[model samples]
Target: MEGFLYQASIYLAAAVIAVPIAARLGLGSVLGYLMAGILIGPAFGLVGQETADLQHFAEFGVVMMLFLIGLELEPRALWDMRHRLLGLGGMQVALTTLVIMGGVMAMGHQWSVGLAIGLIFALSSTAIVLQTLSEKGLMQTKGGRSAFSVLLTQDIAVIPMLALLPLLAMPGGLSSRVNEATDHSDPGLINTAAAHGDTGMSLVDGLPGWGVTLVTLAAVGAIILTGIYLTRPVFRYIHVARLREMYTALALLIVCGISFVMYLVGLSPALGAFLAGVVLANSEFRHELESDIEPFKGLLLGLFFITVGAGINFGLLFGQPFLILGLALAVIVMKGAVLYVLGLVFQLRGRNLWLFTLSLAQAGEFGFVLISFSRQQNVVPGDMTEILLLIVAMSMMITPLLFILYDFLSRRIKDADEALEPDDVDEQARIIIVGIGRFGQIINRFVRSSGYETVVLDHNLAAIQRMRQFGVKGFFGDPTRPEMLHAAGLKDARVLVAALDDPDAAVRLVTFARRERPDLHIIARARDRTQVFRLYQAGANDIVREMFDSSLRAGRYVVENMGLTEFEASELQRTFYQHDRHSVRELAALWDPDMPTVENQEYIARARELEAELETMLLSQLEDSSDSDSDRKSA
Candidate 1:
């Protein structure tokens, strides 16, 4: 109990201090977690010997994370994602593997060893890419969606490669001598004292080479099939346990169980755990399992990155500077080439193509896992693995910067390779409204009553279908597109009014119409000051903030109805209306959490006081007017 408390304290402290600081610095949370691990782990040696052992055990966080990731991805969704899985993702892995393998060969290593190392480096960090995109609020954008599809495919790709690794034997292989270590063979696993003892070994001690391979395959199959058949029932029983903490315990238990099976079969634990997660994706306990496992997964994934960082030997890089540089360049260039071509083939265009390709150019987190696994398999030496791991880590560290680079490149080149221009817009209608919501419908009714022809364009089909049921003449499609505009007859239309609820979409339509039909008068409803700016930018002839203008007209009538002197009523109403407009603009600018605030307390207080005084002034005028009218009547 004392040891557990001591070790937990150390990690807990590291997480609390490091993660927030990293987020504040704009370095991102993953970097912060890794920095914490490095500080407490081998680099600083602050955790001591006892803590090192605990930290190693805590590495289960990553295994659990992968399992949860698998659970979120249903097999059907995965199958639906195959075009990208094979086209974009498969291309990246194959091209990177081949290119890096060639570079390794040029550095005097044989293809057998080079091939193994290259394959390991083909992956990119799924966790980081997904989390970062989400954080940046770009996850639903065209570029963000493309990145997600490619990442999902890569995650699924890792499973097949793990199975394929042992099949890739060394050249002129099969030296049949027991108790003999081959120099040509890379350094195999540093078998621990616990493993060497008679505790676990049974048939592995005397099995032939082929028998050993078969044993591994059989063990793997048994676990996968067992996990498939038993996970749902096991989770159901655990649910009846009715304790949330125990459900978490059960989740961890299941991951460890699957991981152990994979390890015993000489397979990747991450892959097995991931498969277990996939099987449980649709289960009733899925959300509970995810919520329970999320913290550990996050911490462990962070520590795993740090472990990768600590494991990078600077000595190897200094000795083989050129080789390290070559390998890094090869991985990026190869992966990048495949991604670029994929963007074209997959119909990803302009900025989206650039974003998709560049976001995934770096080597992934799984590369570290696989390289560590490959080292144990004797397919690659420790030096080679260490060098490759460092390269992968550096690539990860530069991911944010690379994304920025891709953005810059895309902006500069986007105009040249843009999506095809929309066809000509319609111009024949007597009255055209870009949107058909309540506001637009009112104007549409008024115009139609005047015997003017009215045409409505709305993007939402469901809304249009309902409108059609009411005998409304409305076309359903994106009103922003030129073709849709042309089809709606914008060129001959006497007037165009844009009243879309989404400000951005409305602004887009405003801009498109301005360019196509400069002579037609354009009136747009602005949602707020931002929309006001957008309408102005789009060359709107008249921009109306629906609330602002409505409130102003209402304020004028309210002041007059309250029996105020005419001039006083007009002045008070104007001041208050203008103040309200200014307030909205100021509020919009200050909405961000980090946005700057009013610096002087006195000025802020005075501003509030003045606002109150204006309200009193408006009300006092009404009271004076009321008393004078009574006095005049009595006299």
Candidate 2:
């Protein structure tokens, strides 16, 4: 017990200390985890019991991570992204695999060995791409979304690639004597879940394949049904229990339990868990669950990556220097070539094409599992497999630096152009949005789509840099300054919205905007009651709250009327500008943070009913008035 406690403590401490320091150095968490893994596993020999055992456990983390990602994507969102995934991602994987396979085969390795290596080399790190994009504040930009679509497809493709390993094995039985190989696991949930495969239909060691498959299918079917039928009630029960700690614990339990159950069925736990997460995203408890699980997820995932690093064999790498280097080079070059062409076909021009290509040209974490499985199945030679694993580790280590290089180059060009594009002294845009957050993003879309030119002003250097990638014209300076506003075309803009997320920033910008363009309609953001009144005092013509009213006014109508869903209704209302100035005046004046959600729900329902009733009543009065006038005229 004491030894178990000690080992667990060491793992936790290593992750806690190493990840932050690595991030601070701009090397990213992938490197941080690698450092942690090395410290815990081989480098320091802290938990140096055995390398392979530790890896088997760490591999679970990857599975869990994938399941979680799957949960985030709904069917519709998945459909929307199918093009990029099937086209861009498939092309990237297929072409890269073929190219690398040819290269490896050309070097006199057997075709099977070459095929195993090529598939391993085809994948790029989704974790690295998403993390870099988010860290750089490109999470919502067009380029970011495009990258995300491709990454999503690649992640989904991991399952099929894993299934393909057995087919690539040679006729000869496993030749090399196993170096203390761990006995095969009892056909647990994973194998059962994958029972659709050829081997999945047969007995491997002892477990009944048919029974396992049936049970696994039943488990998945039950979970899906339960999620659809019982989530709201379960959440209500947790909320009523009212212990914040318990509620948070329950959320974690739900995620972890579903994930574990999925693994037992041979499905990816991360994908299963991620599906649960998205279903509950709209719940009131979402923020709480996110806050609780996010910290643990990060640390565990870091441990997973670190384990990947520790698995790298420096001895093997040194022994076959040319092979390892040649493999790594071929993998990167092939991926880059495939990505560059796909980007061009997808109409990703100028900077985004390079950003997409350069950022994703590496062997992915998934490659480790693929190569290892292939070797176990007698598909790849032991030495060849070891070399591929080393290459993956090195490629992952270099990915962050590659991304940073891209950012550095992108900014240099943007800075040069912005400096050179002199302001039109006499002509300025008729609309301006400050901050460019979600709220500001909406206003910018609305104003620009309505035929009014809009210029965005923001203080965040990262946000400004990201927006430039999407071709958003903006002044990357504080809107609180008179000179900055003038430079941003604010003085000439007929409408200025201080839609910053920060209340103080919004107020400061509001005051500056009012002073500079007194006649302009200055819409400002408010966090609460006090902030709205504060904005009103500061001469804001319109003050929108940061909560639901500000975000949802345009969305509710399409839900009551059409075949539209929440997202579609929201988008349509936004596009049509149906919620006019008068409707906002009626709603915004009375909003308070302390107001209960039930009351708001009742009010919206009542308002819709009242609107119909009043319209009918007005029609009746008009008819009577018209008859009286006609009677008087006849007399």
Cα lDDT tens digits, model 2, 1-635, are: 99778877887788789989988988777777778877776567676444445555555555444445445556577678778878887877788788888888898988877777878787777666765676677756656767777776666666667668778878765544122122323111111122222333332325486876687678767677666667768878777877878766876677767866665565555556655655654555556666666655665566667666655665666778887777676667777888888889899865687788877898876676576567667787654555666788778777877777777878886775445433333336777778887778877877788887877777666677787788877666656767767776774678888888778888888887787778889888878756775687678997766774735564466453655455545544453343333444444455444776357775566557646755565456556655876899999
Candidate closest to the true structure, highest TM-score: 2
Candidate 1 wrongly placed segments (more than 4 Å): 1-14, 37-59, 133-242, 314-327, 373-378, 381-383, 407-424, 428-431, 435-635
Instruction: Report RMSD (Å) for each prediction in the order shown.
Output: 10.7, 12.7
Best by lDDT: 1
Clashes of 2: 17
Q: Model 2, which residues run further than 4 Å from truth?
A: 39-42, 63-74, 175-220, 237-249, 278-285, 319-326, 416-635
Decoy 1 TM-score against native: 0.61
